[model samples]
Target: MTELLWYGLIINERTVVNMKKKYFLLALLLLVLVFSLTGCVPGDGANNEEHLAGFFWGIWHGWIAPISLIIGIFKDNIRIYEINNIGWWYDLGFYIAVISGFGGLSLSRRRKK
Candidate 1:
């Protein structure tokens, strides 16, 4: 009877651990879905200015690449562009942020033991 009880407790602990892992994965997946959807919409460019603005805002919040570059130049860290256009740099930064996030997530998941 004692052996059976010990086995049951061990099984229950493992079940709880598995449940926690499942919930963690579910949350991570939801986060990824939210991030991906924030930038993607179904419509032509002509009718999607609002969506594009929201997408760019999201990119700025996540990456802040343009801001980093500006700060770098101000602090004499790098001299890639003397006159950077906000629109072009923002767009490029947004693309880099999205691709890097997706790739990083994929690589991390793939490397899990």
Candidate 2:
């Protein structure tokens, strides 16, 4: 009787473990699909736009840089920095947003008294 009970417990544990693995795989697949689709967005070198990306675009890109980096890893054309940008102003805005976005998170952390 004890042997049967032990066997049942072991099977239950294995089932639970398999379920967890399946869930993990499902989540991973979803993440890959999302990033892969996002990677397809217009990017790389320069597009046919009449106007290049400016300071606002730089800020937007900088904000989503981390996501772009992940997408870039999977897709060849995705880039973190915009190639079609207005020189110094774009760079300045990118830096500002990047610094503030990341740095602000650190600054906003509450310290325990």
Candidate 3:
């Protein structure tokens, strides 16, 4: 009876750990999906025209610059100026926030487990 009880306890502990890992993976996947879909920020401005340019431009400047820079480095012929633009810092902040928010949630969930 004692051996059976010990085995049951061990199985329960393993099950708990497996559940936590599954939840962590799910959360990470959801985070990546949200970031990719939204371009890592809110409000792309679908209806508003005057502000739409600023919104879309901000998204491109923020997210695209790093990607463009990496590609330019690989290509070795692309100019940095072609990818450069104003208001990039704003987009950087948005990306950081999105990544950090998801990261924080993952950390907290791990801690709880």
Candidate 4:
């Protein structure tokens, strides 16, 4: 009858709404998990006392910064930047790479006029 059809439609709408809510919660949970597990931190020590990291190492580190950050979070030996470096040159290269690598991501987006 008409009443039964209305009831079925209402139930279907409720089910759809519930499904949306579930997906939203799942996405939120995944975001929280990802953010909680990844981050950057400075590191310093005599781990590489014999051979200090130079400009090239800085560039390499900057290029792999994201991965290093994640690994650094879980491992004590891994760090985003090297403390025992050649100072200015190392810093310059690190900054250059970090800036360019991250800035490049913005270029991939198409602008709407």
Candidate 5:
């Protein structure tokens, strides 16, 4: 659809409008994906720093787990989970975020509403 528009091939106004809407939706979705997958702020290699990435950070990282995982494959520095977390609470937040981000979405889509 977009290819046709790019090549100056779309002749009908209706087709162009429809394609524009589709492209807009596609762009919006891409934007959401990019933002959702945003990783944490990089830290220095210092060993004695306080780990602020607790529950909130865990939720954010977990929500973007899928994207982070993909990026992790290419980059070594980028990690899905914090190396030094506070404890089980961090794990709790990550699991909650994962379930909400993935499973919750699936559940929502299943309803007609």
Candidate 6:
């Protein structure tokens, strides 16, 4: 682009749009490559082992579950509950987290006019 300006060549709007599309595609390709290279789950038999990640961890992770879901799309071993859990307790924490995180907004008190 600078070279074009230096050469006194006019850049068209179509050219700018094409450049943006190329950059978007490049970034998407890079992300796919990166996510494909990493296995998010640990190799210590996480599928069979349940180490009780506990309530606090469950709450924290659940708060960020949407992010984990996106990452899980590329990795095979990663999951919301597969990373060591205390079964229903973890679920309880997750439910609590999700409810508090989103439901609290809906439950907000309104001031009387």
The order of the candidates by TM-score, greatest first, is 5, 2, 4, 6, 1, 3
Residue lDDT tens for model 3, 1-113: 12225545644666767889999999999998656644422232232434333434444434444444555566664322222223465455545644555566787764443
lDDT of 6 by residue, 62-109 (tens): 676665666668766566554567778777887898789778878896
Question: Each model's TM-score?
Answer: 0.29, 0.58, 0.28, 0.55, 0.62, 0.48
Write out the backbone clash pairs for model 3.
none
Q: In candidate 3, where is summed lDDT lowest over 10 consecutive residues?
A: 40-49
Which has the greatest lDDT? 2
- Please say which candidate is ahead in lDDT: 1 or 5: 5
Model 5 stretches astray by more than 4 angstroms: 1-11, 21-25, 28-32, 39-48, 105-113
Q: Give lDDT: candidate 5, residue 80.
A: 71
lDDT of 4 by residue, 21-112 (tens): 99999999989866553433235453266767778767767876787777777888778888878789989889888988999789788999
TM-score of 2: 0.58
At residue 99, give the lDDT of candidate 4: 87
Pick by TM-score: which candidate is best? 5
Model 2 spans with C-alpha error above 4 angstroms: 1-50
Clash counts for the predictions, in order: 0, 0, 0, 0, 0, 0
lDDT of 4 at 20: 97
In candidate 1, which residue ranges exceed 4 Å CA deviation? Answer: 1-11, 41-113
Error of 3 at 1 (Å): 13
lDDT tens digits, residue span 1-113, model 5: 23345466755767778879999999999998686556352221221246456787678778777776777777776667776667788799999988888888788776567
